[model samples]
Target chain A: MSRESVINWIVLAGLVAVPLWAHLSDEPFTITLATRAVILALAAVGLNIALGIGGLVSLGHAAFFGIGGYTMGILAHHAQTYTPVMEWPLLIEGTKSMPVIWGLSILFSALAAFLIGLLSLRTSGVYFIMITLAFGQMFYYFAISWAEYGGEDGLSIYVRNGFPGVNTLVPIQFYGLCLVALLIVLGFNAALARAPFGLALGAARQVPARVRAVGLDPYRLQLLAFTLSGAITGLAGALFADLNRFVSPTMFSWQLSGELIVFIIIGGVARLFGPVIGAVLFVVLEHWLGGLSDYWHIYLGLMLLGIVLFGRGGVIGMVAGRERSHD
Target chain B: MDLILLAEQILNGLQFGIMLFLMAAGLTLIFGVMGLINLAHGSLYMIGAFCAAAVAGWTGSFTLGLIAALAGAAAAGALIELVVIRRLYDKDHLDQVLATFALILIASEGTRWVFGSFPLFLDIPEALSGPVMLPGGIQYPLYRLALIGAGLGVAAGLFLLIARTRIGIQIRAGENDREMIAALGVDIDRLYTFVFALGAALAGLAGALVGAIQSVQVGMGEPVLILAFVVIVIGGIGSIKGALVGALLVGLTDTLGKIALPGLFGLFLDPAQATQVGSALASMAIYVLMAMVLIWRPTGLYGVRA
Candidate 1:
């Protein structure tokens, strides 16, 4: 096997081995942490489709994320009450099944992504970033105002939405579900990167004018990637809601968007498994530093500054340098 | 709505717009001259508010507090410009964004550590505390009126400085060609530091001035900062004239939309349902305006195309 292949295998093995050991030992906290890592990695992978392949610096992925969470929350609320969402105009009801929630999450996020991406993708550079941020805030304020859906206080799920025979309330089962979703998403991301469309997106990122000159509209490709990215992130948001059994406007906050970017950057932008490393390290640092004191963010800020200044490749890049150099 | 209420809202809008202009002015100047996007511009605003609150609390004088805020923000700006921002001039927008974002974290957390999470309250001076009657029999807060005056004064002063001053001439020249200006022995580093400090001072003044109306606290600058970004974008990035027009337009649009949209919707729909839909639409109104403007004129009203 090649060096990269060996490294990939070892990394994958370590991922399974660590979680498996935690599961065997009945360490709920560790299992929970691992589960969160997987879900967050999935979300970051969604972002990579736009940021890495499409060269779109979206500072508003949290909108889709919150949409996913709200999908679960709104649906679960109706499901628990056993009421149709809209009895007057249309008979739209909530679902108890996870599959239904996931479907809705993807569809909702895809639709939102299309609308936002249409306006945002009109501009490039800093303009795009600012517009996306504005749109995210718009959704955040909307959620905050819509008191029927819990508003600023947020909504709570009475139980884990059903997923066939699996009792999702169990940490191990939920973690397993998250891990599976994460793996599938990762596989999709890697395959997409090597796919013809992915190649075109990458080319557009490198040289948009050149791509345009060659008779391709970069905008359509970016919009498609952006939509796919939103759908995947929406999946993660659904899982996150289930993980916490709560949904709030805070999920859509710019701070959350910033954190997602931090995850991708700390892991190594555009690298497969970059967000994975970033999410794991970020959570681990938060957990560790949070245990030490209430003022952990100060130290976190300093550490981030150090990383940006000195360590450009993030932690994974440090461990695995320039894997299979292309040039 | 009554004419008094309308007039009051307009005054409020102008005050808010002026504050945005103060923030956007510096941002536009920096971007125009340096081609850098500093996300931590908000941090400077926060610093100013904190400085004002702290000074006022210590000395019990609002004027002194305002001065301290300006000086502190300008100093912090100069420090950041020299130590961090100077290196970012030649880098891509992404690098500038990330680095400045890191600065925000540090500044925010650092402020939180120094000052607890609870917001610091700054009192308006007793002299300016009461409402003054305007020409239309509308009662307005004297402090808010003062802010509007200060903003206009700054605007006029800035226009003069940029239009006629020797340094302003150099700045305009520098914006056009940095290398050529530098070759003429214009101490580019000092010019950059001065410009950065000037921007910081403007943000600080806005923060301190607005602190009277709002709470002085960490993260307070973020909302205003975003508004300022909207203003600059709408005005055309790197255009001072654009920033002024954009700020006023945004301030009026946002404030008026919040009041007008709900009322307009209520005229037809039931009050409760109207409120629900109108508020949502109002929140989205500015963005819709932004999108319309972008579609109509991508470069902005006064901004020259990049």
Candidate 2:
């Protein structure tokens, strides 16, 4: 077997081992934290597809994430109140099952991403980055002003949304759900990256002229990749909401989007396992540093600066040595 | 809306656009001359406000405070260029962006470390504090009018500096072709440093000027920075003329949209709902304008195609 496959297997084994240890030892807190890491990693992985592979440099992935969270939050709220999400005419109503919520969340995030990508993708480079940020800010302000839900205060889900035969509220069970979803998304990402479409997407990143000379519309390919990236990220957002049992406009902030990029960078972009490693390291650092002082962000900022300036290859690159030649 | 309210809002937009112009002019120049995107430009604005507030507090003179702020920010800009930013000119936009982003974090935290969390208050000087009567039975704040006057004066000064001076010729040459000028015996590094400092000073002046109207806090430059980015993007990356027109357009659209959209919507909808919708639309108006501009003129209004 190739080195990457071996390493990938080892990592997968470790991921399975963690939850097993948590459940066997009845360490609920550890299980909860691991679950949180997985959810965040899923979000980062979604961002990786856009930023790392497609070179989109989106600074507004948070909009898709928040849309995902709100889909879950809105559905759960309706379910709790014994009300239908939409009672049109006399018979239509939305369901609050886990599968249903996931589907809706993915759909909503993808749709929003499509609309935003349509406008934002028209511009390239710095203009693209700024436009995405502006749209994110636009949605953020909209959420803040639309007080019908939680407004600035945020909305809480009292009970974890139900899944058949599984008490998803149990930390271990939820972690299992997250792990399954994470694996599926990561597999999709890997497949997509190697697929013909992903090749076109990657080609667009390096030279649009070459890609265009090959008879493919770079814009359409990029939009598709962008939309898919949004959908996966939205799925992560739904899981994140379930994990926290809450959704807030803070989820949609540009700061969060920047952090997601930071995660990919720190772990090593374009690698399937990069976001996972980065998220774990980041949460651990934040937790440890947060305990040390109130000014942890200052230290975190400095650390990130040092990493960006001196360590472009990041942790994974350090371990893996110099990069492989894709060309 | 009443005609007076309409006039006031337009003025507000003009004032905002002018403030944005100050920030964008320096930014566009740095980008045009150097091809570097400095996110820490906002930090310079923040520093200007802090320096102004602190100096005003110590010297008890707003004019002195403004002078100190300009000098201090320019000095800080020069220092940063000499020490850190000079290195990044050869780096990619991502590297520049990340490094500058780090500077923002450092500058913001460092400022807070010195100034504490509470906002520093800079009062409007007595000479510019009161209301001034305008021609159409309208009264506007003397300070805001002064800001408009100051902005126009600076614009004129910038025009003169670029048009009628040796430094202007050098700068224009540098912008057109950095290497040719360097080969022709200009001290390119020093010239760049000076331009950066000049831009920083303008940003600082803007900060101190606006600090009286708003809170002078560590993170105060961020919102304005983003708006300035929008202004420059709409104006075109490396064009001062574009920055000027773009800033005013954004300013007027933003300010006037907030006032007019609500009133316009009120004709068909409930006033309260219209206010909510209008305010949201107003906030988004500048961005929409930017998008439309990009759609029609990809290079911006006055941006040379390159």
Candidate 3:
């Protein structure tokens, strides 16, 4: 393996090993923190496929993220209340099955992404960013005003949903579930990055005219990337809601979207495991500094400024060295 | 709707739209001239309101407070441009966004550090506190009328300044060709700083004026910032006239939709369901409107294809 690959392996091992050690040491709280890092990493990784590779600076990925959370929230809420989700064409009851939720999360978020992407792909750069944000705001307002599913107050699932064999109430079992999901997604990401679609998406971002010269429509490529990105993020969101056993409108907030972008930037944009490293770093900082001072965000802001100003390569870029080429 | 109520809502919409214009004009000018998206722009608005509120509290003069807001925001703008924004011109949008997002964090926290977490209050002047009679015997808040009037006056003045003066000529020239303007011996750096400061002052004025009607506090600028973004997007980035038109449409649509949507729902649904659905959908109307506008004109109504 190359030096960068070595670093990636070390980072991946550390991510799994550290949590395992914590779980063995009976530090469930630490495991919870790791779970958070994994979940957020998954979400940010989804964004990286679009933003870093596809050159789509989406400011509204939280809509997809929220879609995931709400899907889980709605299903679990309805299941607890023993109410059917729909009764019109055919009766459909809310389910607490993990596999079913994951499947539906992917479908719902993918469909939402497709519709959102259809409109947003027409514009590029700043217009694209603002339109994405607007759509997110629309979803946010919709959630806040839709009182049936707890509205502004949010929904809660008293019991963790069932997976095939695991007792998800066990902190380590649940953490393991999330970690497996994250690893599978990470593997998929790595494969996708090396695939033909990745090459085309990267080209579309760097030089759309050239890509068009070669006869591939950049818009369609971007839309596909967006849809896939939204789907992965939506899956992460479902996992996150399961981890927390609650969901809120705050998931759709622009701040969450911005933070996701921050993760990718800090970890190293376009890198496969960038968000994994970034999420770990973020959770560590949030936990440690949060204990020390209430004004930790100021420090975060300052650190981000320093990174943007002085550290272009981020952690992986700094340690593993820069990639050979990019726009 | 009653004619009187409709007229009142229209005026309210105008006032809101004008406030948005003040914010959007500054934002578009900066984008056009600098090719930078300063997320910290809203923080400057917050600073303006905070300065006005604090100064008004200390001096007991709303006029003095407004002056402080203008000076405060301009000074903040100039400093940020010199220290932070000047470096971002050649960088890509991602860098600009990250740097500016950092500035937002620093600005917000710093404001909280100085002002404390509690919201500050700013009272309207005694003279403009009451309502004024319009042509159709409609009553409106004098302060709001003055706000509308002030916004329009500033809009006109800004248009004239951009179109008429020597500096205006240079600004327009710089927008068209920065390299040529600099080659012609114009100080590009100073001009940029001036433009940024001018935009800041406008945003600050909006904040100060609105602060009187709403609570002045940290993060107050953020919602308005997003709304302003929506306005500029609808108007077309970098076009002042687009900003104006976009602002009016958004403002009127928002205000009127809030009223009309619920009533429309009431026609078909029960009172409770109508209220819930109407308010929810009304909140989403502007975004839907933006989507439609973009579908019709992808670059926005007045955006130059770049």
Q: Pick the candidate with the highest lDDT.
A: 3
Please say which candidate is ahead in TM-score: 2 or 3.
3
Measured by DockQ, the strongest candidate is 3
List, residue by residue over A50-72, the lDDT tens digit for candidate 3.
Answer: 99889898889999999999999
Pairs that clash in candidate 2 = none
DockQ leaderboard ranking: 3, 1, 2
Per-prediction DockQ comes to 0.60, 0.48, 0.78
Q: Write the per-residue lDDT of candidate 2 for residues A57-87, one digit (tens) a residue.
A: 8878898889999889888887777777676
- The regions of model 1 sitting more than 4 angstroms off are A1-7, A323-327
- TM per prediction: 0.97, 0.94, 0.98
Q: Interface root mean square deviation for model 2, in Å?
A: 1.9
Select the stronger candidate by TM-score from 1 and 2: 1
Worst window of 10 by summed lDDT in candidate 1 chain A? A318-327
Shift in Å, residue B93, candidate 1? 2.2
Checking candidate 1 for backbone clashes, the offending pairs are: none
TM-score of 2: 0.94
TM-score of 3: 0.98
